[model samples]
Target chain A: MSAMTHEEVRELLAAHVMELLLPEERASVVAHLAGCAECAREVESLRATSAELALAAPDRSFDARRCNGVRSRLLARTAADRDARARLAAGQLPEREPLSLRPPHATAPESAGGWRTASMVLAASVAGLILFGGSILVQSRRELAQARESESQRQRLIAGLIGPGVRLIELAPTERRPGSARMFWNQTLGAWTFLAYDLAIPAEGRTYQIWLITPDDRRISAGIFTPSADGNAIATTTYALAADSLTAVAVTEEPAGGVDAPSGDIVLLGAAR
Target chain B: MIADVRSPDDADALVTRVAGGDEHALGVLYDRWSPLVFSVCVHILGDDDEAEEAVEETFWQAWRQAERYDVTRGAVATWLTTIARSRALDRLRASRRRQEETMSHLSETKRAAVDATTRRGDDPARSAEVAERRVLVRQALLALPLEQREVLELAYFRGLSQTEIAEHTGQPLGTVKTRVRLAMEKLRDRLGILRERDA
Candidate 1:
């Protein structure tokens, strides 16, 4: 397409907003839109107007079953998407035909092996978790499996601490427990390794909860884990709180799956300063 | 379970969680907007199966591209609708090409007679605000001049480019562009006024 003046391109602004411009025409209009504030506002206004079309449909009847079907399909697709990304990141999938990582404007269907590959990756990840003592970084919704996977993940975090810029925060031994704990954090990677020394293992139904105190006094659950038969437990988790925003780190005994807040006896309190 | 009502803040929060790879948040977002997304698809594809596929593709794309979603561009619903519209058009355009190739054997009227029924019989607006907004939106579209509305629908719902719309309507390309621009200008003014009133 030949170069068009600003006025000429403005005529196509509506169509451009609707994404009706062919690629070259789109490129021209996009170029014009960049330097022309007036044209850009027009485009935004047109876009807002177009978005309202979503409301223009007739009252659609509610179908719980249909909604559920779509929900399940979306959930499965999302899971598959995450698995594919994880596999690609892990170099487990074929590099030549990586999962489609197209930009938002361009998307393609997953290859036939996409879901099968995802399942394989997930199984492998879970197997790896088991071999590492059942702690793994997984996005699965199964709480029991997640709890088990978290344990092995904790071990990995502890192992990763010695590699780089790791900061160790000491947890003074509490009166009720004679055990001492140390929290090792890799500030750059935002990984935490909690080592509880001589901490007593809770009964089968209970676990130790690690908490991160934000400057705003908000306590976020880091993870939940039980000590081994030897009364020593290590937990590792990815926490993104910066050193300044993190007020302190603490561990408390709580029921499995952790809680919204620290609701149990504090076994160890570590000053993050 | 996804709640029956979700505020705008809820939509933003769900998207944030989705960006963090939270499948449950994605599910909640899907449940919240599936009707609107499906409606856009059905209106464009005019076929249940293709529309269903578009819905799946839209959410799947949303999952993959959640991080790219810019709130400054529009809300979560707007972002999802835009994606749905694009996907539906892709399907519609492919079917259109296939029909054109078979045009030697099939009539245009027959081709246009493909199943246009939506998957559901009733409006799926679970909240009063959504239902009211739908009524206002329909009114706004209806308020547009017939000529403008015709080109707007062709460009938007039918996924026709300006040139294609010109060809379809037997109008000059300039005329088609003018109609689309006029339509958007009117809708923009009208919706702006409505928003101010609501505010």
Candidate 2:
């Protein structure tokens, strides 16, 4: 080993490729390769194998973090499939069509407010992910749905008409809480259609209620409602909403049967406005 | 005791480690074979997005499907390279891309990012060569008459259903069928002749 030239040693280093040689093999490989030229040739061949094992990895900055997000969402969506379908059918929160992914470069940040509004709609739309469980090869199908384009939303000034005497209300965001509903007097629909958007999903087994105002100004009952997937509540007569008794639409915590109205502390207050 | 994983023993140990969720061991496997995989994906599917997407899906799929990976059939690297290649082919088909057309514009951006990263790492040119070599392999693959190469590329790299490949290539369907069985026979013959010459 001591007699070997540096170049010969370097060649054998190929056979024994590494950052540093181990203590046991270090003395032996170094000893023979010092004098033997053919043994040295073998080392060069060995070196190629090590060189072939380069250590580059994919960039981990963005996609690695995104992978964790994908996994959690995949698990949650798969588990909650049943509840999602039930709610969609109950309230008829219109099912959105699949949207194709636009090239990221096609669109750029222009205005802040427009994006903020659009993103809110986008966030709700993406909640329904396509199933990609283990039936097929382990590939996933977690797609995002797009909110209907704004032009379509704006052009469609859709109106709902209740019975001759119906209660209609608008839910606005309040300083303390996000949800607040106010009744509107639309003589066309008689009964009120509660338009609540700022409200988040109510607690399990509980719902928001609408109340009618009697001529004496005493609060009467309208109907109870469960929130849609997007957390907006609509007044449905399937349960208890009757023809017009003009008052206000106040959402109160109610049991399954519901109260005569205005009994619970009002979560939303939509008076004729 | 080994510097390179070239033996049966080494392959077995690595598989054991992989099955145990050893990501570093997975890294070791990746370091050893990513070039083969990346090359194959780029070759079969011209688009970089589909290739990278295929590779990512392939690695994750391999991780989840580790229990099923068998060692008797072929080398682990070959198995993995095959997986990535298959996914890339599937993506290419899904996108309905022609043999030369790229499906994702984002892939070009990714290549730029890789080039920049490599330059910062020192031998940026060598890093670029690694990418170039894959393109060359693709060019070589494309040079083969559309008949045999399509079968070989699809059967070997893309992992298409034979029927599916038959449908896409629009060959006699039976002509597509024989091409794969014959192409593999030719690949083996070429490898055998090379081995004999080396001997």
Fraction of true contacts retained by every candidate, in order, equals 0.61, 0.00
Best by lDDT: 1
Predicted model with the maximum DockQ: 1
TM-score of chain A of each: 0.44, 0.35
The DockQ-derived docking category for candidate 1 is acceptable
Angstrom error of the Cα, residue B46, model 1: value is 1.1
Off by over 4 Å in 2: A1-273, B1-12, B93-147, B154-178, B193-199
A88 Cα displacement, candidate 2 (Å): 30
Stretches of model 1 off by over 4 angstroms after superposition = A62-65, A87-91, A94-273, B1-7, B101-122, B193-199
DockQ-based class of model 2: incorrect
Instruction: Assess every candidate by TM-score.
Output: 0.56, 0.34
RMSD of each: 16.8, 20.5
Residue range B1-199, candidate 2, lDDT tens digits: 1212223456556766767656556555554545555544655565554555555566656655677776543346545755665577578667755445333533442343233223222222123433343233333333445566555444443444556556655667557655654443343333232233225
